[model samples]
Target: MTCFAIARDDLTSPDVLDLLRLHLDEMHSWSPACKVHALPPEKLRAPDVTFYALRDGDRLAAVGALKVLGEGRGELKSMRAAPDYRGRGAGRALLEHLIAEARTRGLIWLGLETGRTVPFLPALRLYESHGFAESTGFGDYVPDEFSLCMELHL
Candidate 1:
């Protein structure tokens, strides 16, 4: 079995930067500019956001972020697994880590927004498998045809 390390990342290194670019590019490809909600690396540096990376040895396999929405609410952001690592459990591992982090912070709710397009079906399924159910837009988000929102109560 491949051992993966999950840790907080500063999002400045070259490999992590490349992974972020790929994630943004794919999100843009699947959704229009107005519908693309994935945060840029710089925006994720905000005090309320915690960014993490999952690595298999020196290879960066996946990345994800958790943004505190206050009042016991949290949002999952920018979750993406490297193409080569897809279906190999990296995404799931990263997501599980984020959920644990949220619980550790005493968050009562965890929400996320993902594209409604076919490209995001796997992601939707992944979230569903983790006990997230479809939910209305939360925080500053508004309902839109291209976006599917889901939340889990911790």
Candidate 2:
């Protein structure tokens, strides 16, 4: 919420990796191990993925990624705001940045999978406000009770 900048992350910074670990831990807490699709650091560095970090000044405020699925489509990955930055618009800032990047890269739509539980309500609301709606599973994901898929047409 205070002078944050969204920039492409190389996924090698110690703070970025620590935040990613926090994101993974939170995901695992809300869903089964098999259903947790948040990418690991090595996977995030894959050729098709473009990771991002939202820095509030020198501190990392949040992180997210866009994984090119080819054919004018992409998937949103690892959208998480640090505890100290949540509810202060850090997530929204990062989300907008990714959507803009997707558009810049010529992606027509963006897809994401998140938990369907009450614990995930805030995230669901955030995505919905940005025009993401209920959708069938994308990528390697499958439709299931614990999983909620959404898509935003860019």
Candidate 3:
């Protein structure tokens, strides 16, 4: 994680909560409330999900999560880099950490649901660069104009 420390977070830190609130607020601004699927802090604390936080010294750098969706599949969620950490390696470091963690957990496939719109282009590109390919919706997700589903066969 370079200069950043990455760890399994309990989602209770004020910084983590602030980031999640910012994430949800950003999602709502980009899409309708119903189309925004970003999970809240309480939901991210579910047993099936593991939340990670990256920190530079005592400052929050980024946050991300992985959810075991059964049958050797995992889902990425709540990926967000702090405003100060944007354009830095923080986001990539956290993403790489999560991907590696997913593999370590014996996940055969990693997938995610994200918005399909201008605000989400950078995120889409990042996932694509990491080998996530556009795919049909999974789990309870439905294909819609506001949604984009992607997967990577591990």
TM-scores of the candidates are 0.97, 0.97, 0.96
Segments of candidate 1 deviating more than 4 angstroms: none
CA lDDT, candidate 2, residue 22: 91
| Every candidate's lDDT | 0.93, 0.92, 0.92
- Candidate 2 residue 127 Cα shift, in angstroms, is 0.2
Better of 1 and 3 by lDDT: 1
Q: 2 or 3: which has the higher TM-score?
A: 2
Q: Judging by TM-score against the true structure, name the best candidate.
A: 1
Residue-wise C-alpha lDDT for candidate 1, range 1-154, written one tens digit per residue:
6789999999999999999999999888888999889998999999999999999999999999999999999999999999999889999999999999999999999999998889999999999999999999887677677898999999
Clashes of each: 0, 0, 0
- Ranking according to TM-score, highest score first: 1, 2, 3
Query: What is residue 16's positional error in candidate 2, in angstroms?
Result: 0.7
